[model samples]
Each structure stands twice: as structure tokens, then as C-alpha cells.
Target: MPRGAVRVDLNISLDGYATTTDQTPENPFGHDWGRLVGAYTATRTFRARVLGDTSGAGTTGVDEAYAEAYFEEVGAEIMGAGMFGLHDHGDDPDWRGWWGENPPFHVPVFVLTHTPHPTLEMEGGTTFRFVDTDIEHALELAHEAAGGKDVRIGGGPTTVRQFLAAGLVDRLHVAIAPILLGRGIRLWDDLRGLEAGYDVVAETADSGTIHLTFRRE
Candidate 1:
């Protein structure tokens, strides 16, 4: 079996923000969160995986291609506490995740957080394991759990930045939406000249979102 790859996929705004601070229970992405990932949400893959819509009422172009690629060959997922609903759940022991019952990720998900929570086993083969460790240890555990398949770095920006800064990311995909989020968590701060270590490519889809791929050189 081929070795697993460390990959990350993110939807960022034109101003390079991955999330807004105005997140509410109703509006998870905050003020302009939808605008950043509207294209992705309308993809066929997203509809099928997230909404469980089998009617195929979604687009099938470049955006859909990227959306499909996001799940390709992925066997395990690593995410931050924020991405796993820690910020919203706080100390709620019953909070499983924002994704009810069956989550879109049908694999083992290792959540990085300081708060230790019991392992959660949900429907569709999704298991949530919380770890309070560094990026190296987290990746080691995720890689082991990956079982020789690709490991996806699911994000809310902060976690991805930490992995990238630590040079543990092998491949990165970022979709840049055509909007400016003046206030939010920026993804490219203090990471100047970060593209030098990767073979980069950029494509602009019809939805006006630029999809960027960075493969380690």
C-alpha cells in the first residue's frame, strides 16, 4: 500500500480569512461565512455527503471537482477543537458535534484540543477522539489511525496554520472566494514566503473562486 499523504483543504476569503468571529449557533460562519464557501456548499459532493441528497441537484463543474477531490483517498481526519464544536459546546459533556448522527467524515477524526473529552462514536463510522498534544504527536496518532490511507487536515484556519508552520503538511488545497472578510481569523498571517517549499498551481473556477494546490517540493 502506498503511504498516506497529509493534505488540507480550506475555503478562504479574498482577504485570506477562513472564519469570522461573529459565529452564532444559527450562523456558524459568522457574518459573511456563507459567501466564503457558497460555491462548495452547492457542489454535488457537498450535497450528497452533508445534506444526504441523492437527487443530484448540485453543480458538477470545477467547484464540484475540487469538492469531490477533498474526500478522495482520505481515510482519517484531524481537526481542531473549534472545528469539532468545542468553542460552542464549552463544558457540555453531551455535545457530540455540530454534525448530527452521521457526520460527513466517515472515518476516524482526531480533534486537537486542550480540553479532554471522552471518545464519541457516531453513526457512519465516525469516531471523535480528543487529544491535548503537539502537532507532531497529533499527526503521529492520526497517521497511525489512517491505516495507510491519506490523512485530511480539516480546519477552521488556526489548526491548519499550526500544522503548516510546523512543516507537517504535505499537500494543501485552498479555495479563495471572491469576497473580502475584513474581520476574521486570517490564514496567511506571519507565513510569508511559505509558498517557496511547494509546487503551486492556481485555477479560477466559473464561480470566481480560485482553487490553489500546493504540493511539497
Candidate 2:
């Protein structure tokens, strides 16, 4: 049997920003975050998986195709502290996650942070495990939890960048939303000449979202 591959998928803007700074108390995710991930969320796959809308609605084109692949063959996921809402509500012991009763990721999700928290088991097969260890150790734990399936590096850009910089990712996929955010966390900041390590491919969707994929050669 083959071991699982470490993969990552993210949504970015044309200006290379992966996150925005317009977050407020009422709108925690920021308004632009929706615009950034608008295309993927509009897909039928996202509707069925995340929103539980099995009405057979939504587009089934390139965007949907990538959305479908996002959940394929993955048994475990690793995310950053920010991705788990720890940065905002770390003190709230009752704060589970942004996903509510049940998160879309049914697999085990390991959250990397400087602090540790108790494991949270949700309604579905999802289990949230906090890791205060390093990136490589987190991947090791995720791989074990995956049970032979692929391990996904699901993130908030910073975590993804660290993993990519350490040459830990086997596949990196980014959906470039056709908008320019002037200020935010940029994905390709210090990682110059990243293409030399991976075979890259790009595909444009009907929504004008360009899907860029980089696979280690």
C-alpha cells in the first residue's frame, strides 16, 4: 500500500493576498473572505457537502470540479491556529470552531498552535486535535490518523507557507479569485522561485477564477 500524500488547497486573490484585514466583531471572517472563496462555495459540491443543500442546485463546471477534488481521498487535515479560530477566541473554552454543529471536514483535523486544547469530537466523523508541536510532528500525527489516506494541509496561508518552505507539501493547489485586495496576507511573499520545485498547471473557470496547481516533480 502507498503512503498518503501531503497536499494543500487555498483561495487567493489576483494580487497574491490569501486573507483580508476587514474583520469585525459582527463579521468575523471579513466580507472580502466571502468574495475570495465565492467561486468554490457556489459549486454544487460545496452545497452538498458544507451547506447540506442536496437540491441538485449550483454550477457543475470547472469550479465544481475543483471543489469536488478538495474532499477527495483525504482522511485527515492539518490547519493553523487562525484557521481554527484560536487566534480570536482562544480563551473561550466553549468555542468549538467556525463550522458550527458539524464541520464539512469529516476527517480528523489537527490544529497547530502555541497553546494546546482538549480534543473536540463533533457530530460527524470529524475530530479536532490540537497540536503544540512543530510542523513535521503535526504531519506525522495527521498521517497516522489518516489510516492510509492522503493528509491535507488545510490552512490560513501562514501555516501553508511554512509547510511549503520546509518542502513538506506534495501538492499545492490555489484558486486565484479574479479580484485584487490591496492589503492582506500574501501567499507568495518570501517563497521566490517556488516553481522550480514543482510541476505547475493552471486552469481558468467560468467564474474567472484561475486554478493553479503545483505538484512536486
Q: Which candidate tops TM-score?
A: 2
User: Tens digits of per-residue lDDT for model 1 on 12-109?
Assistant: 98899888667788875566767778999999999998888999999888999999998788988999999989997969999998978888888999
Quickly count the clashes in candidate 1: 0
Best by the lDDT measure: 2
- Note the clash tally of each candidate: 0, 0
- Report the lDDT tens digits of candidate 2 across residue range 1-217: 4679999999999999998888999998899999999999999999988888989998889999999999899999999999999987999989998877688889999999888799999988889999899999999999999999999999889999999988999999999999999998899989988888799999999899999999999
Off by over 4 Å in 2: 25-28
Q: Which regions of candidate 1 are displaced past 4 Å?
A: 22-31
lDDT of each: 0.89, 0.92
Cα RMSD of all models vs. native, in order, equals 1.7, 1.4
TM-score for candidate 1, residues paired by index: 0.93
